[model samples]
Target chain A: MNIKEISEDRLVIFKDKNTLTIKEHEKLISLMQQIEESMMPILNVNVSYNAVTVQWDIFKMDVNDVKENIQTLIKNLDHIKIETLEKKIVEIPVCYDSEFGIDQDKFDMPIEELIELHTKNEYRVYMLGFLPGFMYLGGLDKRLYKERLDTPRKKIDKGSVGIAGGQTGVYPQNAPGGWNIIGRTPIEMVKEGIPIVRPGNYVKFNSITIDEYRRLNNDKNN
Target chain B: MIRIIKPGMYSSIQDLGRTGVEKFGQSESGAMNFRAMMLSNKMLDNPLSNPVIEMTIVGPEFEVLKDITIAVFGTEKIRLNGSIVSTASFIELKEGDHVKVGRLLDTRGYIAVDGRMNSNHILGSQSVHSQLLDIHPLRKGDVIKIDGANEASLEKKIMSKYPTVKTYKGKPVIRVMIGEDAERVKNLDSFFKESYTIQSDSNRMAIKLSGTKIEADEYDIVSDVTRLGLIQVTKDGNPMVLMNDRQTTGGYLRLGTVAKVDLPILADARLESLVYFEEISIEDARALYNEEMERIQGTYYLP
Candidate 1:
């Protein structure tokens, strides 16, 4: 493990490896949670594929002291065995009708085949960024992988499900994105003020009809 | 209460912004010009974190419904009841008074009232992220409610202009500290030697610069948590200074972060404004921060 200082108040803990497996990710998550629980001055902690960034209050502690403490914590992380963390499986209902799929024609397969390929598998939430509640999901069927649009659409509707490269996820908000859209979910991706699926959560997509999408969408609005 | 007669380019209510919430994919949305916001709030005897209306180049026109005292900072083109008034000072307004903030010479301006604004506090912040949250920016004919209006009888005083607030003229030199990938950048010297112009697309999220391509072997990095003033070098070989509304994390090579003391200057830079960069150590940056804070604390005075 290596710790690189971004600034006096922020540093990132990352391994030398290029990518991380699911098991390594769980360990990284445990180490992140431990750091958050132990450091009172830590303001926020965010994790990516194989790294964790720690931001803290500079006024409360010295940079050198914080660095040394993080080093000690890393040494201790190996001796401690962590239990399998509890993860919630969030079921998201999506409408795969060509009417909602703006870019369904981009794929070579038929609309029904596209839906089957999308809904048959479960995906894991690797991280969340780009937009609020927009999950960076892993575990896409290789057949579904496609390159992003060369010229991205100016505006993409919220809850629009799309695939780009090796990832598939839903747009949590209406914004400009480059992902190829296949379908959309009616339910709000962000409930209250928090995202529905967090880092360790699993997401399973359930196919629904266009009429069902409207009904659920209306119910959400009301 | 107040009503917006005309909502200028981009005006939104903001405070010091949210912390400890990046894990939820939330950006730290706040005032771009932190120093100006602090000055306005302090002048009104409000807490430093008090919400203020942040205005862009063009500012809003407000019709005061109740008697209140407000302070406008970082701009000189302000009018009270159709008469020009000095900015960076406390001004008392009675009901039915119309205050207009004209086109600002500075890139941004701030207006702080004496009471709490009645706005949505999602995840403990009044900062409006129209895309992420249900809140929207100020619009024409929108009514704003304040919790305790007409309360503070602030002494009418025209304060001195803060030295850190830069009204852009020539190319301003912004200082920075070493970043994690500074050594990896092949042409790091070009960042300091070349003068860049702020792109028109720049907003609260980031200020994109065009000039002097600072290249590297590769620009992608494992995404990680980002801070307020991080200077991210994109794949296009141009540098963009991450601002208040930057995402929680990004996947680009960071050259360095703008010094805490110099972020106000960056926030006040106008579109197409010339910019230069200089390097500073972390210790020096911290020292400058302390000096700026002391200057602010000692400068808050009344007649």
Candidate 2:
């Protein structure tokens, strides 16, 4: 694999591929996993779509030395093609009832069609951000697309799934959000105090009855 | 037990933040001005990562229920029973002693108690991410549990010679290490030459930059994990410098990240302050950070 690398003293920047294909992402993920498991005296790793920023703890050793170690590791990994994560589909239960789906009427399509389009295709968890456990899931079908609201709500309930423009995600906690809400999930993201849907996981949304939502919500509160 | 008599503007309990939680989509929510927190911790002979009261703009009013050694780092507006207490100096507090701090000279400050703080941690951190967890921000009438007494039984205190606070006289020049893909950024050659002012939309998550519309050659990029000090330039031509409360991943094209050593300086910068970035080697940044750390650890009273 070819790579373009640069550094600002202790911060190293590496970007080999312009586009982040699944294979390239898998390689980056596997590289990160290898780095995580290494005994290298690194500080933190910030992975972006195609570029990776690495910070090292200089107190432990020399920055150049750490860079050399990373180069060697990358070389060894280049010799072996890394495989993508094992396919694990997390089936999420989304309730699109009027009470839960505040933006049901705001949607362009009928509520039933909206839910059908949403639940049909599985989404790829690209990343998690904005809020803890707030997964930025890819694969939003164009038919269900909607831009964000002009005025953001001061409070979007936790477990509320929202759509903004071409993106869709779950609000892990009750917080201020700008996305258009279409449904609610009873899965408590706070169980582990963080979202468990690690990047690279496939998520399939399943429609559940309002009663089922109530049951799951009741189980969570208790 | 420390009872909060008045929970200042934004005073909250924060440590250095959690680690290895980026996989869970969590930003390491920690103290904004880490240097101030570190100095206070060093003064009390406490581990740098120990929990401390992170007060900002204004400070909190509290009653120390137990005698403890405390170190205040930041502005010199802190007082014990109305008597002014110099920052970076250790003060032995007796039971029932009331501590109050006035508005700070900087945007943020820190108060480090001698012992471990009784705080609730989620995902291996006691730091509060107001948007996600409720474990942060000291509340009124809430009781904070801390070590009953000063752990360092030293007869006297020796303070470090480091400046009590970092003051930005004017638009300061912050060093930046452009990412490898920085060549794809708009105005790459002149981005460093042009100056940018801190935008009002800045926060703990990131500092948005005004004046310069620093865009990238290609805007659409993969959303990836982020860290403190990463500068993400949005499509609107705004460059936001991520901080302690930054999200785990972002989609904006990054120009580069601010050096770790200069993060506190940027954090303490006032809104709309003039700022510039000088391209530097990562080694230079590390040297500066090491030099600063050495200065703080120079005259430690304890091993």
Output the number of the lDDT-best candidate: 1
Model 2, TM vs. native: 0.87
* Lowest summed lDDT window (length 10), candidate 1 chain A: A79-88
Tens-digit lDDT track of model 1 for A1-222: 888777657788888897898888877777788888885589878878778888887878877887788888888878777667776789999998888798999999998889999998878887887777878887899999999999999999988999987779998888898999999999988876688877878899999999999999999999
Interface RMSD, per-candidate values to 1 decimal = 1.7, 3.4
What local lDDT does model 1 show for residue A122?
79
Listed in order, each prediction's TM-score against the native is 0.92, 0.87
> Which parts of model 1 are misplaced by more than 4 Å?
A110-113, B149-158, B164-170, B298-303
Deviation in angstroms for A146 in model 2? 3.6
Following a full C-alpha superposition, what root-mean-square deviation does model 2 have from the true structure?
3.5
- lDDT tens digits, residue span B47-119, model 2: 8788988876788999988777788766765788989877646788899999998887766778888888888
Q: Can you give the DockQ of every candidate in the order shown?
A: 0.60, 0.49
Q: With candidate 2 superimposed using the best TM-score fit, by how many Å does residue A221's alpha carbon deviate from the native?
A: 1.3
